[model samples]
Target: MKILLIEDDLDLGNGVRIALADHGFDVVWVRQQEDALRQLDTGACELVLLDLGLPDGDGMRILVRLRHERQNLPVIILSARDALEDRLRGLDGGADDYLVKPFVLAELLSRVKALARRSYGFDGDMLEVRGLTLHVPTRRVMIGERTVELTASEYALLKLLMVRADRVVTRRLLEDEALPGAHENASNALDVHMGNLRRKIGEGFVRTVRGVGYVVDTAAPYKVGE
Candidate 1:
């Protein structure tokens, strides 16, 4: 998952960034609201951790602007304001979750996971497509009684495809999700990964769209070629 953290406190920001990164999340930290807005414009972040106080402007204003522009992007308020009215205002202004200052990192991480699951329309950490099961939090894949081990990159790629199962996921989207902050490689690299993934998961699990990209056919049973 990719997260944009808009925080001004160097110590707190670094700590949060490190913790989230350790949990397999790509985090981009920006101390200023302008930088946060710029990152949003790139359409790279899956979630936003916004502080109510920013160097350039109020963080709430950024949240309002984001909702005004892209209403679907999940925004979680991370601020020191613990007042009831403050929490109410944040939610009313389109913040998905509110975290008061001096919160535990575990709680913050949990909230992030919850928000991500909600955004993806997942009922829990486990993602089910046909008979294949992917445990998002544990990064485990189960095909019937057999367990499949996957590298981080492979897991990332599979997760992206599985989340958007039955829909065509373009190579550009997969590349962005798999490798954030890196130059895009040729399509052949993705093809190689997909090839390996299909072999491990089962042949015909992921269908290629020729010139388009790939899609996980959740409605179809896994079938090896004739």
Candidate 2:
């Protein structure tokens, strides 16, 4: 999914951009409020990660303006201000989530996912593609009436692919987002985990894109062994 990241700090903005990209999100980063508003006018981004402090303006105004124009667009406030009043103001000003500075990237990613699930109208805790069901909270996978037990890495990999079914999830994105530390040292951890997941879930559900990555096609017919 595409995200508009409005951050003025060079270090934080770059870090967030790289992290989001690694997690398979297309990010359009702007350091100023005007640029952010202009980007919003284009209606290109699906989500917005906003910073309250900007060079030209306060982000709260942007949030207010955005709410007036696009009430349904999802916005997450990323700011250094941590006072209770500020938090309440942001939440009440149409921000979906407010994350303070010096926060963990993993937590930010989790919030982003949660907000995306809500905004995209996903079935709360469940993510289903074809007959494969993934229980998000318990981390359970079910194919038909049988349960499928997967390793931690395998589950992460499969969950990401399934959540983005029909989209080509890149190798870099899969390694960085799913495998994490295992992807380092140029190891075949992603391949190994993917192979295991395919074996457990049956083949043909996931198709390889040669050197690029993998895609899970929900519409394609999945025969037992073709």
Candidate 3:
């Protein structure tokens, strides 16, 4: 998952970024609301962890602007304000969830997962592409009864693909999801990860669309190979 963290506190922002990255999420941390708005324009972030107080401007304004433009993007207010009116205003202004300061990282993670599930209608941590199963929480892949172990990058790539199964996911999209708000290392980096994933899963599991991008062949038959 890719997240945009809008927090002015340098230490908190860095800590959240590192923690989320360690938990297999691509996070882009911005200290100011303006930068957060700019990053949102790229349409790469799946979620936003926004602070109500920002250096440049009020984060509520950013939230309002985002809802005015794209109402479906999930935004969770992460701030110190615990007043009932503040929480009410945030929700009324289009925030998906609210988290106060000194919150547990685990709770924040759970909220992100909940938002993803609500957005995609995924019932559990396991993402299903036809018969292939990817357990997101465990980073485990199951092709029938046999299990395939994938590296962290490979797991991340596969999860992204499965979330949008049968859709052509561009290299740019993959790269953005891998490293949010940063320039991609190379054009072939996605290909390398995809190749590694395919080798572990199966040859025909993923398909290349020539100059377009790649797609997971959700209809292909897969079995546990001994």
Candidate No. with top lDDT: 2
Q: What Cα-based lDDT does every candidate model obtain? A: 0.82, 0.84, 0.80
How well does candidate 2 score on lDDT at residue 44? 53
Worst 10 residues of 1 by lDDT: 179-188
Give the alpha carbon lDDT tens digit for every residue of 83-199 in model 2.
999999999999999999989988898898789777652333567877888876577899989999999888888877876677678888888767777657799888888898999
State the lDDT at 178 in candidate 1.
82
Off by over 4 Å in 2: 121-226
What TM value does model 3 have?
Answer: 0.70
Model 3: per-residue Cα lDDT at residue 77: 95
lDDT tens digits by residue: candidate 1, 1-226:
6789999999999999998877767689999988988999877677899999887899988988999888988898999999999999999999999999998998998888788777754433667777788876688899987899988888988887776667677777777778553335444677677888888998757888887778887677545793
Clashes of each: 0, 0, 0
Over 70-94, each residue of candidate 3 has an lDDT whose tens digit, in order, gives: 7877899999999999999999999
